[model samples]
Target: MLDLVSRPAPWHQPIWQQLTAQQDFAHAYLFSGQPGGGKRRFASAFAAFLMCDAPEHGFACDQCRSCHLRLAGSHPDLLLLEPEEEGKAIRVDAVRQLVDFISQTAQQGGRKVVVLQPAEAMNVNAANALLKSLEEPSAQTYLLLISDQPSRLLPTVRSRCRVQPLGLPAGTEALAWLTEQGGERSREECALLLQMAGGAPLLALTLAQQDALAQREKVVEGIKALLKGQVAPSRLAEQWNAVPIELLLDWFCAWTLDLLKLQQGAVEHATSADMEKVLGYMAQKLEVQRLLAWQDWLLEHRRLFASKANLNRVLFLEKALVQWKNLLQRR
Candidate 1:
C-alpha cells in the first residue's frame, strides 16, 4: 500500500477520457513513455478509479471507502511492484509474490490492481515468471506496467499488454505547468530546465527544485578544467562520485551533442548556452566524427548505468574522462 493521490495532471485529461470511456479494459496495460512523462501517475489514478465503490466522470470518488483506503495507503487490493532499491533489478522472488497476490481474492470485493513501475527493471527470470500471469490474467485483476524503456522488456511480455505510448506536453504547456509547480523560476530558467529535461514538465520542475543548473555548471567547469590539463581524471571522478551517475552521463551526453551541433553550425538548436564557451572550445579542438563517437559512447554508458551493471563508478568515470582528455591531444 502506497499513499498516492489520484490527481491527474492537465496533460493527462485526454488520455484519461479515452481510457475511462471504455467499458472493458485489457488485463494488462503497458504505459510506455520517456522518464517523467507521468505514466506512473496515470496508472495510479486509474487503479484508484477501478477500485472505487463509486467512480464519477472517469475518476475515483474521493469520498468512497476504497478511495479512502487508497488515500490512507491501506488499499487491500492495490499492489505496487518495483525494484527493492533504486537501480536494482526486480527479482524473481518479487514476481513470485505478485503471482501469489494475484491468486488471492480481492479484499475489497472489487478489482485488484498491480502497478509495476519501470517494468524493464525486472530481471529475466522475474519477467519470465510474470508472463504466465499476463497471458492468462484472473478476472477483475488489472496489471499496469509502466516503463521508461519498453524495449528492454522481453518480446513475449511486450506482446501481451496493450501498449499505450505517452508523449511529452507541448513546450508552452510544459513551461506553464513547470512555472506553476516550481513557483520561483523565471520563464527563461523554466525554459532551460524544460530543455534540459527534454520538455518533460515534471522533470523540469524537479530540476528547478533541485538547482540542477548549478550542478550542471560544476560539471561543465570540470570538463573545461580537464581539457586545460588542470585536473586528473581520477580526481574529477572522485569529485563527481557523489552525483547520480545516470544524471552525470546524461549531462555529458548533452554536452557532447551540443559540441557536435556547434561544429556543424547548429548553435541555435544547442541546449546549453551556459556552456557555450566550453562547447565552442571543444568544437574547435575535437573533430566532428570524434565528437559523434563520444556521444555514442555516452549513450551506451547511460544505458549500462540505467540497467545497474556492476561497473566501478569511479573507475568508469575515470576512463571516460581520460578518453575525453586524450581527444584534446589528438590532431
Candidate 2:
C-alpha cells in the first residue's frame, strides 16, 4: 500500500529530485538504511517513475500503462528479488533469475528496474551470483539493492554499487508521519519502535500495527506467570519455544529496560503501562548491573541465533532465566 503520497515527507521529496536530475544512472545502486524508513517505497516509486510513459517531474503518472501495471502489481520491469519462503537466506537460484531478467530486453524496450530488498539477507552463494550480474550489467537495466545492515553484504557487492543511506527523520517529522497515520501521538510507542527498528518509518508503522494490544497482553500474562515463581522456567520455555528467539529477546529487552529507566526517574517514554508491571517486579530483584549484564547476555544470544547455525533456543532461554530467577530467589 506504500506509494509516493504515503511515503515519509523527507524521502518523498529529496530522492525524487536527485533521480530526476540524473541524465543516466549507474547499473547498480544500493539503498541502505534502517528498516521501514521508506527505502522500499522509494525503490518502488522510482521504478514506477522510470517506467512511466508520462511522468510528472520524476514522479509516476498513475494513469500511464506502466504505472497502471505497477498499481495492479503486474509490472514486468518492476521485479522484486527476495529470500525464498521457508529459507532464511536469499538463494543463488533467485539471483540467477534476476540476472536473466535484467539481461533481457525490457517488455516495452524501455528502462528496467530490479529491486532486491534486505540485500544483506543474501548468503555467500547468492551474493556471488549477484556479483556476476553487477560485474557486467545490461545497458538499460538498473539494480537497486535495499539493505538494513550494509555490513552484512559482501565487500565486493558494496564496491560495485553507489550506496544511498537513509536516516531517521527528526522528531517533528516523525510525529507528522504518525499524525498522518491518525494516532494520538504516543511518543512512547513511537520511540520504542524507532529504536528497535533502527529508524525505519515503515518498520515502525508495521510494528505499531502488530496486534500489539493482543501480543502485549500475552507478554504481560507471561511475565506475571514467571513472577509467581511457581511457574517452571521449562514451562515458560515451552510456551515461547517455537517463537523466534529474536522476537522473544527483543520484546524482553524493551519491556524490561524501559522499567529500569522509569525507576531511575528518567522520563517514562516508550514503555506501555503493561510493560511497567514486569519492570516493577524486576527492579525489586535486580540491581542495575545485574539487569544490564542479563540484557547483554540476551543480545549476544540473539546474534548467535541469527547466524548460520541451529540451537536449542528453549534451553538457552531457560538457562538465561534460571540465572535471573535464582538472583530473585536469593534476594
Candidate 3:
C-alpha cells in the first residue's frame, strides 16, 4: 500500500507549494511519468492535501478528522481504482462502479477524491465509461489519474484533465536522495543503480532491493558470449528464465538507442560502461537500415510486453537473441 500521508518527494516540493496555494482546483488531474518517478506518491500527497480540513505549510495536517480517516484506510469519500491483478486491463465494470461512486453525496460532507493509478490500464470500454465522469464532474470533487504511459490513454480522456508531467530530477539531487535511502550502499553503487533506473531515485532504490545488479551482470555476460559465438541463443534464453522480461527489454532498448547514437557519430563513446565495447563494435559493423529494422522489431515486442500478451518466454528470448546476433552478420 502507498504511504498516503507522507510528504512529496524532494524534487516535487516546489510543485506541492504551487498546488496547495491554489484558490481553486481542477476537477480532474493527470499525473504522468516513467515508472518509479514519484508520480504515485505525488498524487497521494496531493489527494491528502486536497481532502484535509486543515492544511499547514502546503501539506496535510495529519491531526484532522479527514486525515485520521484517510490514514486508517477508511475514508468514505476517497475511492481508489486499480486493476484487480497487476498488468491486467481495468475492466468496464470497474469504471461503472466509479461512476456510481461519483453519483453519491460525500459521506464525510467534504470534497470527494478518486485516485486511479496506471490509468493507461483502462481498456477502451473502461476509458469510454470514464469519459462521462470526466465530462460531468460533481461539485467539490477531484479525480486524479496516474499513468506511466500517458500516450496510451485516449485523446478525449487526456484532453479533459490538467496534465502534470513528473520527469527525472537533477542528477545530483537524485543521487543524494538515493544515497540516503540506500543505507549501507556505497555512493558508487547508488550511482550505478540511479543510472540503471534512468535517474529516477525511487526506481533506483527499488532496483537495489531487487538485486538487479547481479541480474544485469548475467545478461551482459550472456550478450558478450552470444556475440562471440561461445553460447547458443536457445541456451542463453534458458539461462535467463529467472530474469524479468520487462527489465531485459528496457536494457536492450537503451542499448539500441545507444547504438544509433554511436553509428551517427553523435557520441564518441557509449553511455553505459558495461556494454561500451560491444555497442562500439556493433555500431561499426551494423548498417543504418538494419539497425533501424531491429529497433522497429524490438519496440513492437516491447508494446506486447506492456500489454501483457501471453508469450512463450523461451521462444521470445531465443528469437530476440537470434535477431540481435544477426545484426553483426554481413548483408
Winning model by TM-score: 3
Regions more than 4 Å wrong, model 1: 1-3, 225-235, 266-269
Taking all chains together, each candidate's TM-score versus the true structure is 0.90, 0.79, 0.92
Q: How close is candidate 2 to the true structure, as a TM-score?
A: 0.79
Worst 10-residue lDDT window, candidate 3:
1-10
Residue pair clashes in candidate 1: none
For each candidate, the alpha-carbon lDDT, in order, equals: 0.84, 0.72, 0.91
Candidate 3: pairs in clash: none
Order the candidate numbers by TM-score, best to worst: 3, 1, 2
lDDT of 3: 0.91
Cα-based lDDT at residue 267, candidate 3: 99
